[model samples]
Every structure is written in C-alpha cells, then in structure tokens.
Target chain A: MTTVTQEAGAPFGAAPPPADGAGESAIVTEGLTKRFRGGQVAVNALDLAVPRGSVFGFLGPNGSGKTTTIRMLLGLVTPTAGTHSVLGLPATQALPRVGALVEGPAFYPYLSGTANLLRFDAADPTAPRTTARRRVAEALERVGLSAAAGKRYRNYSLGMRQRLAIAAALLGPRELLILDEPTNGLDPQGTREVRALVKEIAADGTTVFVSSHLLAEVEQMCTHAAIMRTGTLVAQGTIASLSGGLATRVRIETPDTADAARVLGTFGLADVRSEAGQVTAELGGHAPERINAALVEEGVAVRGLAVLRPSLEDVFVGLTGEGFDVDG
Target chain B: MSTVDTSTSPGAGSGVRAGEARRTPGLVPVAETLETTERHARPETPTPPVPSARERWAFWRLLGSELGLTFRRPRNLAMLAVIACVPVIIGVTLRIVGGQGGMGGIIADVAGNSLMLTFFALSFLVLLMMPVAVTVVAGDSVAGEAGAGTLRYLLAAPAGRTRLLLVKYLNAAIYAYAVTAVVALSALLTGLVLFPAGPVTLLSGTTITMAEGLLRILIAVGYVGAGMAALAAIGLALSTFTEVSIGAIAGTIVLVIVCQVLRAIPELDSITPYLLPTWFTNFDAVLRAPVDFGALREGLVAFGAYIALFGSIAWARFSGKDITS
Candidate 1:
C-alpha cells in the first residue's frame, strides 16, 4: 500500500526536471543508467524529459536500448543508477497510470481479444469492475477491434494483436501511454491503422512515448523526437528543433558548374560538391541569396537554385550513421 | 477525475476528451486515482470514488483469471489425467493382485476401505507427482508470462510487483490443492466401486469409523495440498530467474530432487530436517488416529522458511530485472 519511496530524491519531489512551463511532463529521468550483469551497460546515463500530451517519439535502431530505456521508465526494469518519475510521481507509483506496449503486445494466446482486455483491466487494482464491461466494449470499438473481440488471440493477425494491445492500454483512462515499436512487423495497412490510433490517443490529451526504429514513422506521427544510439541518447527535442540543428544543403544547377563552384567557394561554405552542371554545398550560416549573388557577380549562368531542408530521415542518419528502415 | 469530451473540433473525438480533461474544474490529482475508462463521453454519470491500491488487490478477479488460465490449459488437464489415473491404477491393481506391498502394506487395506485409498496415494502424490505438477504450474505462471511478452504490460498495471507475484502464487496454489483433491477423490471413488467400503486402520495401529475415516481422508487431501505450497514457492522463485517456463519447471524439480537425494545420504542425516522434500513425504503421517503435529509442525516451519527465502529472492530479482522481451 505504501507505494512511493523518498530515497535518493524521488524524481517527482518538487523537482525542476518534471516541471514544464508550457505543459506538465508525464515522464522525467535524470542520468538514468542500467548495467546488467557481466558488466554489460544496456542503457547509459539517460537524461529524458518528456512533456505531457505530446506524441513523443523514441527513435533508435535495433539493440540501441530503446526497449531497455522504456522498461526502466515503466518500472519493469530498475535503474542501476539515477532517478525517474512518471506523471509527477516515482516510477513505482506513476507507472500504474501508464499503459505500455513494450516490444509489441503480448497476451495469453488462448484467450479471446476481449477476454484478454478484461483480464488486464482486472489486474489493475484501481480499475472499477462494475463498468468493466462497458469499458471493454468501448476500448474494442475505439481500436476498431470490436469484430475480433470473440476471436482467440492466437488466431489474430499481427495487426489485430497490436490493436488489441492498444485496446489493453485503452482499457482504462491513462495519463501516459508508452508504446515500443507499436508498428513492428505490421503490414502497411496495419501500420497506417496503428498510426491513426496513436494520433487519436495522443489527441485525447495523453502523453504518448512511442519508440520505433522507423524514422519515417516517427516523422509522420511524433510532435517531439529523441534519437538514441548504442544504448545512449545522442539528441532529443521537438521534431522541429531536431530538424533545425542539421544542415540544409543549397542545391544549384548552372550551365557553368566550375564557375559556380568556384564562386560559391568564395563564401567558404562547408562541404562543397560539384558534378556536371550542378553544385550542392552545406551553406551553414550563409544566406542562399549571398551564394546566388556571389555566383551571379562572377558571370555564372544560374539556371535553377533552391534551399533544400533536411528531412527527419536525413537528420536521423546524420545523428547516428545508420539509415532507418523507412516506411516499414 | 472525470471529464467527458465536450469539444466539437473537427476530428475531435480524442481532442474533445483531452480538452475537457485539461479544462475540467477541480480534477482529481493524477496521483490519487486512475479513473481512466472513457465512458461514452457522457457527463451525467457522477465520478466514482476510485478504490485504493489495497482495495483493488482485494478483488478476486485477478486470481480467478490466473486460475482459469492455468487449470484450463491442455497440458494441465493431461497432468490431471495422469494423476487421476494413478489412483485408478492403484485401486485396480490392488483388487486384482490381492497383494499389499506398496506403501509398506497400506495397499491391501485400500481393497476393503475406500478411505484408506488416500493414504495409499499419499507417497506417490507428495514424493513425485504433486511436486512436479506444482512446479509446472507455479513456474509457468510468471516466467511464461515474461516469455510471452505479457509481463511488461502486466507490470505496468495498477497493481505492484508484490501483488502480481502474490496473485500468481495463489493461483498456482489453488491448482496444487485442486490437483491433490482430484487424486484423493478419484482414489476414494475407485476404492468404493472396485472394492468394499468399511473401517480404516491408521498407520499408528488405531481403528476409526468409516465416516470419520472419510473426513480424515479429506483432511489429508487438504494437508497434502498445504505441503505442496513449498514447491510452489520454489517454482515461483525459479520462475523469476528466467523467461522460459520449462527452464523454471525443470530447475525446480532438479533442485528439489537434489535436496531429496541429499536427505537420503546417511552422511547428511544431521541436516535431514532442513531438506525441502522431507516434509513433503510426511503427508501420510498426519492420517493417524491421534494426528501428530510435531512432524507436520516442523514441516510447516520448513515450508515457511523455504517460502521466505525463495519468495524474497523472487521479489528482489523481479523488482530489479530489466525486461528486454
């Protein structure tokens, strides 16, 4: 019955980490670390601050400790060091309010989808039993799983299983919903179905922490994103902010590529590359106008020019040298 | 605590609900109650006072579900079939062979008195089948969940790890008791039809009436079930260490068997009372007319000690484990 502990400064204790001036955070972790036996560091000194009501993307490649980090945040895995809180309470207490689908949804293969939802709902000591029937129906209906409610889980397609797991998360009114690769192994239609559901859930004012290895999925679904690599967080912020830090190449096509390259080189822009009649350069702080003006001043015919912004996928590869499985 | 979605934004089903929640007057602190069943977006129903953690755990629904899952499995039914067949085989063989060699001469009595069949079945149930069956059930309860990828979701439920472990253990215990009772009941029925029904003589050389003897058999059935609790704890303890149920089940049986082998060695007689399965074999000792509580008492102490040692280990391991699956 005594859920919260005061040892080592509980993360929710009037701490600045969890406070969000614009909106309260559903999760906050300060240097959270986990070192498994045999001296294997699974997750290293993670510092996370997830704002409430945002669809936060946890982006990392396979074996990057994304699931491990989520487990630690959900209290399924205790941290070797550091502290975390969910919804302004210690992990132990805040976790109950969090509904998670870690590494895909797992349920008794023998039970019907509806029965599994009921079983999970009943497991929550706080879930009221009287309205359980209504809740189950609503969850299934909302997830578009009402038809498969009577079907056994083993018989469900990967998509149905994922949706059922989402229904399990939706069985109660949750403040924070943590999904780790909710779309893993799903077909395109199933992936789209799940993405729509996540948006809906987040729209309901629940802070969603969704982890995935797909950059395109994160770009499409998340308002904010955090990238991890080899068990450590490399970068994190709003999708816009993370996108802002990466370089946007200035591409130019001209009849005289050599002249353009030489004139563009006057600005000393980083990484200038030229081929045939086109030239591209990472004009970090130089205005596209300045590059164009310099080229025109030197009598280079500029046929076309554009400032191309980096997509989230480009930023992802730049941040972690590994290209994500886009749209999969 | 309760806010029905009232906003009318385009594509506003979830939007309205969230807006209502953020703007709702005097919402219950998020920490107090997890009142999150989205109820038809109707604002008329009064918010129910959410139950405390203690109140939630008190609901028997969780135990019922686990019990249903464990006992309803095909493998569990197969185990019950094998156990049920034990009593039938004993009864039929005793009726045909007309010999009482098993259990040091209790088999012959099983022919005339159905009540003594429980006693005849005791050595087999306690020493072999009960422990194995219990290990399977208890071991599979937690580790199996982990392997199936359900433990991560279950841990995030409102219940704490301590409570989840308790519910799982209790469900397996119920299965243990059910298995023991089924065997005793089967033997009793087989003895009645295959042989005659009359008075039963306890191993202590005292005579008891038929009705009292039947009552004693029921008590023995329950008592044997109690003895199996130690094995359940061992199975659960082993379960917390691995995601594979077979590993836990096999590990439990191996550990218990090693303990039994150690107890059998004359050199280890000094520590005989500390063995895991020694008290397990004492299920028959309680069937005597003047039931001796000394052995049963010592057995209970040993059982409690095993439970405490292994139960705490399970809690500690589970509390800290990082569930990658």
Candidate 2:
C-alpha cells in the first residue's frame, strides 16, 4: 500500500459531485469551517456531499477533525463559517429525524441501559411516548444487548457500553445516522458485529455517515468515503472511483532485476523500483502483456508477473501525504 | 497475460452473514432486523407526522425523567438525607440540654414550644446547609451531564437547548423544595416527640394558637424554598460555564459564602438586602401576626429578581455554547 505516493492533484479536495446532484445528498456542506478560540482551525472549508443511501465513511487519522466535523454536522458544535444541511434541512431543524452517537456512548452511569434509552427517547419530542417502552426493548435487542438491558451503564463492559450507544441511536427510525468512532472500544468480535449492523442499516436505504480512522472498517463497510487530514478533505468519492483513480502496479519477480527495471523505465512506467531480484512500476493505462513482451525481448527474464490494485489505504496515504494507521 | 491477485477485499455481505450466525447466541432472538429495514424503505410523507396525544405531552415526560434522575442519584439523595438529619440532630440535642444554661434567644424560645424548633432549625440551616443542598442539585445539572459526556447526546437528541435548560432549572427547583420540606418535617416531628406542643410564642411576645403556629411554619417553608430556588438559578448559570460539576458546585457555594460574609459586615448594610442569603432568613416575618406582608413581599421580590436575572444568564450562556464534551 505504501509503495506508491502519487500527488492526487486538483481533482482531490474538490467536492465530489454527486451523480444525482444535491437533491440526493443526505448531507451537504458549503465551505464549512470551525476555528477554535485559540486560533486553531479544527475543520477548514469542508465541502462534503454525502450521497443518499450510501454508507459514507469520513475516514481520517486521529485528530484530523473527524469528531469536530461530526459535532458540527450534528449541531453539537456551531461552525465558525459557511453552512451545512442534513436530510435536506438545516442541521438543527432536521435533528429530530437524525440519530447520533457522538464521540462515544454516554448515558447516566447509574441508570440501567433500558432506563437510559427511555430517557433519551423521551428527550426527542417527535418520539411518541406510547411506543417508547416497546421501541427501547426492540433497540436493545437489535444491538444484542437484551441480556444486559437491565445492567447499569457503569457496570457494563466496554463492548456493552458501545452497543448500548448504538441502541440509543436506533430508538427511532432515523433518516440520517451520524456515528463518530462507532467501534472505538469494542472487542474484535464486537467490532465485526457493529460493521455488520451498519451495513444492515444502510441496506435499508437510510443514509449512514460514519467517521473513523480505521481504514479496514471503512473499506469493508462504506460504499463511499471522504478522507480527511489536518481538518481539510483530502479526497472523496465512491469506493471504486477512489481506487480506480490510481494506477495498477505491475510486479515481476526475476533474477534480472536490473534489466527488468531498465526495460520498465524505457516503457515510461511511473515509480519503477528494483529490489531483491524483483521490479515494480505503476502500469498507468499500459497493457500488462506488452510490458511483459518488452521485458522478454530485452533478455530480462520475467519469472512471474502480477498486477495489483491499490487498496483504499494506499489511495488515502497518496492523497494526504501521510500514512494512516491501518490497525484497529 | 493472466492476472494473479493475492489480496481479496472482504465483501460487505460476508460480514453481515457472520454477524447473523453469531447473533443466534444472543440472549434475545433478533427478529426485527429485516422488519425495520422494510419500515425504513417505505416511501413516507416528506413532512413530519402530526404528534400523537402522548407525544404532545413529551415535555412533561422529559421533566419527569429529569426529576427521577435527580432524586435517584445516590449523591443527591445522600445530601438530602444529611439535610433531614441536621434538623433532627438539632431537636434531639436541644431536648437533651432541656433549655438549661442560658443558651438564650432562639434556644429558650424553642424550649417553650415544639413548633419554635422548626423555626429555629430553618434559621440555622437556611444560611448554609440549605444553600449547599440546593447548589449540589442545580450546580451539577448541566455540568454533570457534560462531565459524563452525555450532554452531547442530549443535545443531539434535539432536546432543544432552551428546553433542556428549563428542565434543569425546574429539576433543581423541585429538589430545593424537597430539601426544605425534609428539614421542616423532620424538625417538626422530632420537636413534637421530644418537646411540649402548645400555642406558640411569637417574637413580639404574643401567643398564638397551635393551628396558627403550624400555618406560620408552612408559610416559612414556602419562603425558604423560594429563596433556595433563586439560589439554584445562580447555580444553574454557573453550571453552564464549565464541564466539571465540582467546579460549578464549589463556585455556587463560594458565591453564597461571599454573600453571607458581606452580609455580616455592618458597613455593607446597603448591599445586604441585595444578597440572596440576606433574605433567606426573612421568613421570620411569618412569626408576626397578620404576617408582616411588607418584609415578606420584599423578600419575595428579591428572590424573584434573582431567579429572573440568573435564569436569563443561564439561558443565554447555554443556548449558544458549543457542547465539546
């Protein structure tokens, strides 16, 4: 993944024009900016268009303004400049139909999971109290927390706490769900469960906007992703479009590494490197068969050749000029 | 040329299938995973549904939830229990001493009648104990939620900022009344069991019927409760300034102490009436016949002024504040 670091150029950082236009975007921000009182810009002029019905992943390394951006999108923090809309309405006005778990799961530590959900549900004026109890129970069960529904939040394991936060967000049918670092403290099994739950929710056509630093999580769960670094968007688009924009690399293992590198350099491939009896280069719009034929004609024995598509991690690092932590 | 790929990106569906398999061991069977999916897919109206009867009353529901949380907290309940015990301790100790040794003034008055002990305890607690108890509830209202990181959830629940602030203030106000009632009831009970019950002696040296004396104590409780509620408003305002509950709690207590300290200075007489604690003990006006409406009204107005001023401060600070916590 780190083998290539091509400059993404002007096409990056520019807003991804949604295929169906602004009407289909669940969230739209126009130069949204947030500058703290200490003169630090946490989020700077972000123009995001989260397509409707897409599992949009706001991927960034730690402290890259992921939480701050989520907070501003949810109206927990007001932006210093520009405007943003959620679910086709102003952020605050559309909040009733939006369910969010910001930063982490937070509830009355003394109250049971069931009671905490009841209180959160009560706070939503649009949520009918008539069905609150049943809804709360269903939410808990959906997150597989029924066994621990009566457990005090303070006594819960970290995974249980994370699940309960998800339960709270699912209390009502939300048109938009904004979750920041949803799987932060969960165990590996719990993390997989949450990823599945996110997919299930997104499959139902609810636009899910999830922010995380985990590249694997985003790669697996998201249909589209926006990469952030130092408060500005590095790149964003459909998962296929993001990776498709990068060049496919050609790797050949042979004893004539120097000859293979020389032949590949003559073919004008990018970043051709020879190491340990192997040679690799970005085959940008080049025929792999032609490259192999040229290598063989030049007496460079091509023992084996493989073409590799750059992963999302590679795409992000290329755009941001920084390696994102791939581990959970 | 054939392509050989080593790394395979996991499909989204495989994870869901694995999740489904693992979910079979969940305590409760997951039934609505598909049901809710269909529910969300249905093309619904663009506008929000008109609220049902139950939803219309959600304000009161949230208030009830807030009150339940406030009263149910072990810390707040412990403070209340301690407040109740102070009056009882004062009554039992007074009874043991039996008005011997010229303890004088309120002590001698309390020895004369059981009802006077209620007034004596109110005077003793209104200055410090009651303020501390009220501050604990009100001071922690917003700051505690922020400290625990629940404030963001509540705000995102779209608990309108103004509405949330109102609920916090009302919760504190209700708790203040609870504290006052606890003190008065405990004192009244202990005094009746230990001291003589009869017509009460007034500060004016006039004796009134036991029924009238109880009425005066009831009025005094209201007066003190109102004062504490006003103090709670100040606590709520301070609560909005920080994420740490202890900071707000201590800030409120320090303000009250500063007011009391200023009130004690003879040269600061001009500013004494403006201090919240200064009017706290003005419930003594209820002891006079026909109820000294002038003094009582002045104290009520002061309390009202404090509530109005600080309540606005809290609303202004809270509504525009960013919830980073």
Predicted structure with the largest TM-score when compared to the true one: 2
| Residue pairs with clashing backbones, model 2 | none
> Which docking band does candidate 2 fall into?
incorrect
What tens-digit string does per-residue lDDT give for candidate 2 at A51-163? 88899999998888989999998888889999998867677766766889898888888899999999998887667787889999999999999999998998999999999
Chain B, per-candidate TM-score: 0.79, 0.83
> Root-mean-square deviation of each candidate, in angstroms?
10.1, 14.0
lDDT for each residue of candidate 1 in B142-241, tens digit (9 for 90 to 100): 8998899888777777556787888888888888888888888888888888876777777777888888887777767766787788789889988999
- Scoring each candidate complex against the real one, what DockQ results? 0.23, 0.22
Model 1 per-residue lDDT at B229: 81
**Best model number under lDDT:** 2
Off by over 4 Å in 2: A1-22, A258-273, A283-304, A325-328, B1-54, B99-104
lDDT value for model 2: 0.85
- TM-score for every candidate vs. truth? 0.81, 0.86
